[model samples]
Target: MADPRGLATLPPIRGRVQQAAPLAPFTWFRVGGPAEWLVRPADMDDLLLLLRDLPDQVPLAVIGAASNLIIRDGGVRGVVLRLAGKGFGDIVLEDDGIIAGAAALDAVVAEHAAAAGLAGLEFLSGIPGAVGGAVAMNAGAYGAEVKDVLDWAEVATPRGLLRLTAAEFGFAYRKAVLPTRGVVARARFRARPGQPAAIAVRMAEIRAAREATQPVRARTGGSTFKNPPGEKAWALVDVAGCRGLVRGGAQVSEKHTNFLLNLGSATAADIEGLGEEVRARVLASSGITLEWEIQRIGEVMP
Candidate 1:
């Protein structure tokens, strides 16, 4: 069946727009149906215009690296805006800070910061998403988070572009209270000076640690569930005996209990079903209901 939503209804913009764009290729999970509309804005100005001119009735969603997302099989039914790396991937080094574009990979940003002798952002090397996603979720690993170094972030809201401070974001464990319709454009981080060699060594250590503990080479989402307060999620999952548990082609990662893997030919339903099963078992066994760390979007197939 042809899509009922017409592209002609959208405002003209200097970017690529597609109707019924396949979303699976954009995510780590590699499962899901097409997006109703996918818009990749050429630059910040282009993005702003789209946001400002887009009708109030039309919903909009912004995706960064798509590292920590799960688009449902039924697909997303709105404009999915992505910032193209060519225009939104700059990394600028300041005397005491680093400014990174929303599309800049987190690992690349860490590497750039290290080359500039910045110390505090080494933790970003271990995170898989881009800077915007990191800021949106307060992404963290190995004892540090985006909130620790983020001085401010530039966001495009329906009203206009604005610079928001870390405090204003109301950051919490694995989350940030950003505007519902805002799109993170770029971010500034404050870092102290250190020897480049030392920063590189720290990043290397982080990489080695993650490689050893995570299913880095598999088709998987990073972490499935958030750790309950004072409790490690992986340990709880292990205790619940969900390690290596399989449903259809999805399995709890044998290497890491919290990581869910799609062992080839897994549907989005299979993976999501397996996760819910884990949560149910964990809740029954430990009485601590786990919250999801990875963001699941779109609708389920009828």
Candidate 2:
């Protein structure tokens, strides 16, 4: 399929937008088709111009590090917005807080904050997504979530840019109350003083734990399902005899039953279908339906 508008003709703004961009390279799964148009804006102003000028009917999808995403086989239509190095990857240290660009890697932010003697964000050291995705999904590890430390955020809505206070985000378990069509530009998190060496030790521990319990090196979309109240999704999955289960090249991670792995040659459908099977099996076995925590998007190929 060809892009009718030919994105290259849009006359060189500060940003570079591409046509028919392969999405696999951008996601953790390493599977999926191309994006109709992929735009990497240079900065907030550039992004704003692209967004405002985009036709109302043209759909928009923003992705961060793509650690928890699975773009389908047929690809994404309209515009797929991704922030580039200069545009949205800065990590700044403020007196009592850290302001991170939405595209900054969670681990990078954690490392920089720890170096600056900022404590309480060590949990982010283990998460492998961008700041925006972390906020959107309330990404967490070791019992701490993004919502817990966030003081406020810089967001861009359809109407205009605004600073959103912590309370305004209406943070909840695994969710943020962002506007339906809004984009997170940056976030501010407050932290306390702590020894940099001590924070590094904590971060190392988190890394080791993740390595031992998860398929961190494998092509996976992190945790597959949210835990049901009073019961862990992994426990139920193991009880249902789903650990090490495989459907084609997709398998339930033997290290962590909550994770689904793409064994080199898996397709998006294979991964998604396996996830669905896991949900069904858990529901049938434990009478509790499992909800996917991973973000599944794009289209299925015929």
Candidate 3:
């Protein structure tokens, strides 16, 4: 599925590169078109090189483990970077904290921390996506957020690498004001020593609670909309009669109204359109407009 525009102008790298790569298979919703050019760098050095050398005119985006993300129908243009493999997925314990690569799964990191008797990161067990996405956005769940435990994060901007402390991130509700074209390469999270058994019990409770409340087995992105100032998004959705609402092959989860399911046959447009419909309904039912928590990227088909 290589395109004629090709990889000639792109810098050579040790990692894999694919043109017109299908993205739906890896994403949570399992619907979307190909990436125009998908680059998976072999290591930090490879990624930094690509970031520093990539042409400024070329559009760049990092899609880590594609949770809480929707890739639209017409596909993403230019380069899409996905961090994974041995180089990017490693997790190491150091100084009562963990240094997790951008590709490390949030749950995996939580497990690693629990094994080492690290207490503070148990909340990550219930969050979706990778360490990089968690850091990029101030990902939180079950009463804790990235900002609470992060010591520092290493980011690769087009200019090069910069390790910013937690205060430097300027994190707010579910977001951060990072440098332009910044790709979070890795992050160090501080933790305190705790009883491993207690940490295990806490992690288990969070996991069980999440599984019982959310559609963990469904083809759905987690948390469709953010909780408004002092209100809950799901409650607003339920009050608006959006529970089990369907659009094409997309349906609001019966288990949790905030989640929209792919139902095996949804297109990216179907999923996103359903979300917009939910937002519109919520707005009409209540004066408050729901803000999207799941990120919609790529392009929409006409």
lDDT of each: 0.90, 0.87, 0.92
lDDT (10s digit) by residue, model 2, range 1-302:
66465443443557878889999999999999899988888899887777666666677898889999999999998789887686788999987889999999899999988988989999998998999888877788898999889988888766778798878888877778888567899999889988999999999999999988999999999988988889899999999889999998999999999999999999999999999999899889999999989998888998
With a 3 Å backbone cut-off (N, CA, C), the pairs that clash in candidate 1 are none
Question: Where is the poorest 10-residue window by lDDT in model 3?
Answer: 1-10
Error of 3 at 226 (Å): 0.7
Model 3 residue 268 lDDT score: 94
Q: Which of the numbered candidates is closest to the native, going by highest lDDT?
A: 3
lDDT of model 2, residue 292 = 88
Q: Tens digit of lDDT per residue, candidate 1, span 1-302? A: 55345445787988999989999988898998888899998998898898888877777777888888888899998799999767799999998989999999999998988988988999999999999999999999999989999999999887899999999999999989877589899999999999998898899999999989999999998999999999999999999999999999899999999999989989899999999999999999999999999888888999
TM-score (all chains, Cα) for each model? 0.97, 0.95, 0.97
* TM-score, prediction 3: 0.97
Q: In candidate 3, what are the lDDT values of residues 1-302, reduced to their tens digit?
A: 65444345787888999999999988999999899899999998899888888877788878998999999999998899999999989999975899999999999999999998889999999998999999988999999899999999999887889999999999999998789889999999999899999999998999899989999999999999999999999999999999999999999999999999999899999999999999999999998899999998899887
Higher-ranked by TM-score: 1 or 2: 1
Ten contiguous residues with the weakest lDDT in model 1:
1-10
